[model samples]
Target: MHRIFEFDDIIRAVLQHVESSATDLVNVAMTCSRLAGPALDILWSRQSSLARLIMCLPQDTWEGKVEGCCRDYIVRLSREPTPIEWEHLRANASRVRRLVSIDGFTDAPKLPRGPVLRRRTDGIGSALDLFRPILRPDVIGHVLKRLFEQFPPATLFPNLCELHFEAVFGLLERSSKFWLLRQFISPGLQALRFDITGIPTHEVEQLFAALPTEAHGLRQLSVSAGNGTAALTVPPSLGKLPKLIRLAIFAIDVSLTRQMITNIQQARCLQTLKLNLCGTSCDASGIPLELPSLKTLYLSEGSLSQCTHFLRQVTTRQLSRINISYRGSASPAEVTAFVESLSTSCQTFEHLERIYVVDKSDHPDYLLVIPLHSEIFRPLFKFKRLSSVKFIGIGNFELDDRFLKDVPIAWPSIQELKFISWKRRAFYSVTFTAMMSLAFRCRSLQTLHLTVDATQSTTIPRAPDGTEALWPTQTALRNLHLGYSRVSKVARVPYFLAEVFPTLWSFKFYERYLRNCAADIDLRLALEKAHSQLGALRNSPYENSDKLWENDSDDSGT
Candidate 1:
């Protein structure tokens, strides 16, 4: 074979591009011996189910049946496999690096969903009816135990690096799957994620207590207590993971939240931490916790007070991104306090690049009129490197022209800026002129979503000599979402927008903001026409511009 093919790295890289296409990989393996090893390795590197490895055994080793009201596909060992069958299984099992088992099933069963009445002469059923079933936790536990007796658990998948096991069964059913999950854990494992529902709290505690010894090299871990389960306890020994770098816990409570924070301080290498507090409140009167290595933090399903408390305690200068989501309403003072804590926690704002603060509640009656005043957002303005900022589901923002002009100067590197309100307001002070200031100053801005007062007539500014003033065009901006923004003189607005944002393609506004108004409908149609015109102008040559405009007007009339 060629010298390039002799190098395993080159062959592996070539095989990875076609790894998703099993047929092509198989063809390459069968075509050349030099390519076969790498091809087969890539093919089995990531497995979503264990059924393929089981089928590698002798055809008669296992029997399949469709059972239960859900028509779950199940398999049982009819007879023990011999030495030759075991060898076939071992050949491919060693190649797996990532194994994922979701919803207590390895693979989606391909068997017929309709009921089968006929039975074969052997009394099992038709040949086609014997396809793999949705393996239950109990059935999988039995099959895995029997198979492990033939081969040691550690030797089954020695090269496995990542394992994601999720099952949505009840207490007893999930308890059985835990055994199967334990067999997959090895010292070589680096990442593990579990999302089992209805499992007892003690079981979760025990699993984490043993992780340090079972998987010493683990760097990333994520666990979620499925719906209706109690808060997950944070085992003290979980901090013993020497190489742990990323950890995410969902559906945890207040006291355990404090314990979790205290426990993870021992994880010196941790860089990413995510917690879902389930809207529980906690006291913030404690010494600040320092996470020197943490770079990203995400907290969700928390109350405004709870989220503020967590931020106040966390002192991480290296943090680059923070996503905070709370459920209920918050007064202006409470919102300011939360933002103040965030700024104080991050010692230096230079490292912070992205900030996402959202209020997930949608009760219109609870909406508050939080003015978009400079003083309220002064803390966030210190983050010079900020790139993306999103605030969704918040109450009515009393926006004005001054705040809009100040935004560009604060975060010049901003790429995406979104401010969404829950209810429509009758009046807005900010006009189209203020939005143009952002396009002119923040050249890198791409996505912008804000409500502005566009009800005035569209007129191009003129210079002292009576000629139209030249304004800088922003080509990076592609999407503009004006939620619940009122607009009038819609005919000229589209042409004015095309001048400022030459490459703008998407212009969105809510028509339901004023359902009975005729102006809102006209604005939507005008924006639609501008979108079509810009799209065609970009694709066509300059010589065809006139022809395109002619076609645009003809289409607009209809």
Candidate 2:
């Protein structure tokens, strides 16, 4: 035996690499007496379903049958398994650290909306087929509940720590799934993701209220309710969890939002919060809610006023990221108010790094015409540490070269800056000069998306010595997306880009806007030529390729 295998930590570490492949882990386990326990322990640590553990019981204890019009394979419990037969299950059950209950029929044929028909089969089939069959969640729940009646329930899965209970389809009975989930909620459980899409609102409330008592050590919890379902209320008992750090809830109403904020006020350890507000208004009656340790916040499915109202009432100095998505058109005043709320509510702006605001409304006429001025975005300029700023489908921005110049100065560490509008503006004042400003100023920038008027001729800035002011390689920008930006001198554009942003490799444009336009066609061809040249240069063995920018002055029309 090798000395490396003598160390249990080393053995476990080696097994971690092959844990994803069950066959490899099983082979390792059976390879030798020394590797068996650790290999099996690694194999059973995380389980997607309860099918495998149940199959470990005596061969006669349960049987696999292929029945019903859909021809679904299912495992059915025969007589109750005695204590001797339960040993195999108990051994593996003790190793389980995470159990996720997704729908059993995820890959199965979509049957007509009706109860699944079941037919018992004679206990005879291919050994490989009978080895493991998809166990119906409801049947497994029933069998497990029956087994718990005979064996000690508390000791079933002693090491289980994480449980994700998600059932989108209505195949599993509410009672059975909940019962099975409840049995896994031990004091040591750290994370729980409960997607109660089909579960009744009252039942969801009841289960949420019982979580703190059932799993006091829970550090992360996510609850999601389906759209059009009854609104879910946040139970006060959930706030009692001492170590809760992250919480995300979907499809909640205004009243429940207030309740959630009020309940989690003193949860000082809470770091991340995501809420999908369902109501149009989320006014918290002027009373401010403070979360001292919160670092990230995601607000979606609310109106502009509702999201702003919610933001104004919260104070978290440690906030680093905020994502807000709302429906309907937002006026300049509304956008200003939302940005102002962030500037005021967050006492310190140094920690704030990312801000993403997107409009979900689909009406192009109503959404596209709203013009947002640079003054409306001035409030965010104070956050010096801002790295990523993304605004999608909100409205058209009247940005120019001057505003682009100030952006890099304001947010020097900015990496990803996107201003994506759903509709293309007929005319844009921003020219390639704005692009040059970003390439020269923002050193950390990796992704840039803007609508610039490339049709107009603009001179590249020159240094005092009369050379083109270029960062040839310093600029980290790799992806540049020109969104409906008009371009006429396509042949000169690519070479100019190579001179300014040598590292830029991915360039994208809205092709729909290119229909029947000569300039658009030229622009597309120019980009393809640049990509081909870059590919050839990268594949070449030359140490220094001067030909990269040799065609910088190419005037030949595409």
* Residues 1-558 of candidate 2: C-alpha lDDT, one tens digit per residue: 677788888888888777656556666665566787786676566665555566666657777666666654455688777776677578667887766544221212121121121212231111112222243423344665566665554587788776666632124566666665666677898877766665666766777777778888998877766632446666777788889988777767865566768887756788888777786555446667888899888887778878888887788889998888787788878988998999877989899998888887655454247787777887888999999888876787777777787898899999988877645453376777677667668999988878787766657668899987644454598777776666655435565666677677666656544567776687666545544555465553212221322112111110
Question: Whole-model lDDT for model 2 versus the true structure?
Answer: 0.67
Regions more than 4 Å wrong, model 1: 1-3, 27-30, 63-75, 101-139, 167-172, 195-207, 362-374, 422-427, 458-467, 512-558
What lDDT, from 0 to 1, does candidate 1 have?
0.66
RMSD of 2: 8.6
- Cα RMSDs, all models: 8.6, 8.6
Q: What TM-score, to 2 decimals, does candidate 2 have? A: 0.81
Clash counts per candidate, in order, are: 2, 0
State the lDDT of candidate 1 residue by residue for 309-392, as single tens digits. 887777997999888777777777788888899887998888998877777664544335655544677678889999888776
